[model samples]
Target: MRILGVDPGSRITGYGVIELADTKPRYVASGCIRTRNDALEQRLAQIYAGLSELIGQHRPEVVAVERVFMSKNADSALKLGQARGAAIVCVANHGLAMEEYAPRQIKQAVTGQGGADKIQVQHMVTAVLGLNATPQEDAADALAAALTYAYSRSGLVAAGSVSSKRKSSSWRHFTP
Candidate 1:
């Protein structure tokens, strides 16, 4: 099964694709979709278009996305939410199965630590996927998300087993 993970941002959305062969996760592709400093509507459109093209190229069977977390800055959080919404919409339009994970859950699944920093996550992602070099922060996060789903689906890590504080949502199909 192929999974596409997305870390949505207003300025730079990151995406990573990974395929599960048996119980192992293999890296397929990872990159960022950068948008110009333009109006919010324009940036959203760019995100939609970029992800649409990516889905077409990768043909992932499912998509995993990071859930937006509340930030100290309300404006920034709002923009982040908008970007996440755009990504979710894109995946829905493609009629793919989608899963959402929290940042902490993703970290735990990848690094065995819920509070792992970006550098730690990146290092673990590189090591786990046997990549030549560490991926960018956002891209690594995206990969971690994909790996999290892969692990859960493979029973390497049970769903919602990372913490008792949070519950994992089941994958849902979206029709456009």
Candidate 2:
């Protein structure tokens, strides 16, 4: 299965593509869609159009988005929500399933700790995907989100685990 992970932001939305096969996840492509700060409408349009093109190019089975948390800036949070909504609409328009994962959940799923910092997440993402170098920070975060979704769906199976049943499946229901 091919999965697209999204980290939505008004000015810069990060995206990563990963292919899941035989209990392993591999990186395919990753990048960010950046928009100018001056034009809100144009920025939203750019995000939507860029995402649509990405979906067409990757043809992912599903899209996993990082859920929004309460931001200190209500304005920033609202803008992020708009960007996220646009991303979701693009996914639905492409007829793909959508899933939202909390930032903490994604961190824990990938790094085994909810409080993992961006650098820690990046290192783990690099190691997990066998990347020669760490991806761009935003792109790496998106990739982490994708891998997190794959592992979470597979019963929290850690990399290189040979067990039939992995960690407890309790987190499945908690996923949105």
Candidate 3:
């Protein structure tokens, strides 16, 4: 199954694509969606548009987004929330299934610890996907999100909800 993971931000939104097959993950793509320094709404619009284009291009089976991590700055937090909402709206409009995972959950899945730092996450992401180099901070975070979902999904496959090819029997409500 192809999975698109999103790491949303006000100035830059990162995206990663991975194809999971036979308990192994193949890296497809990863990059940051940089938004112009403009008004908040315009930046949010850019995020939505860029993510919409990515979904159209990649056509992922599922989109996993990192949940909001409350920042010390309220304004920053609000902007991030807006950015996340914009991205979420774009994916929902594409008629795709979406899942939300906490940032710590993502880090834990990728690095075996919820307190892993950016460098650690990058290293694990590289190792897990067999990349030649560590991905950028945001991109690694996105890939981590995708990897988290794929690992979280293993229980369903064990439970016979998925076939050998990762073909599914259900969409939502199956949590691991």
* Model 3 lDDT per residue over 41-79, tens place: 999999999998899899999988998998899999999
Ranking by TM-score: 1, 3, 2
Reference-based TM-score of each model: 0.91, 0.87, 0.87
Best by TM-score: 1
Better structure of 1 and 3 per lDDT: 1
Better candidate number, 2 or 3, judged by lDDT: 3
Q: Per-residue alpha-carbon lDDT of model 1 for 1-176, expressed as tens digits?
A: 99999999999999999999999999999999999999999999999999999999999998889999989999999999999999988887787888888899999888888889999999999999999999999999999989988998888886566432222223224323
In model 3, the Cα lDDT at residue 67 comes to: 89
Please identify which of the two predictions, 1 or 3, would achieve the higher TM-score against the true structure: 1
Deviation in Å, model 1, residue 94 alpha carbon: 0.6
Question: Across residues 31-149, which tens digit of lDDT does each residue of candidate 2 receive?
Answer: 99998876777888899999999999999987888888899999999999999888877776676777778888788888888889999989999999999988877788889888877
| Between candidates 1 and 2, the lDDT winner | 1
All candidates' lDDT scores?
0.89, 0.83, 0.85
Tell me the spans in candidate 1 whose CA falls farther than 4 Å from its real position: 162-176
The better-scoring model by TM-score among 1 and 2 is 1
Q: Candidate 1: how many backbone clashes? A: 0
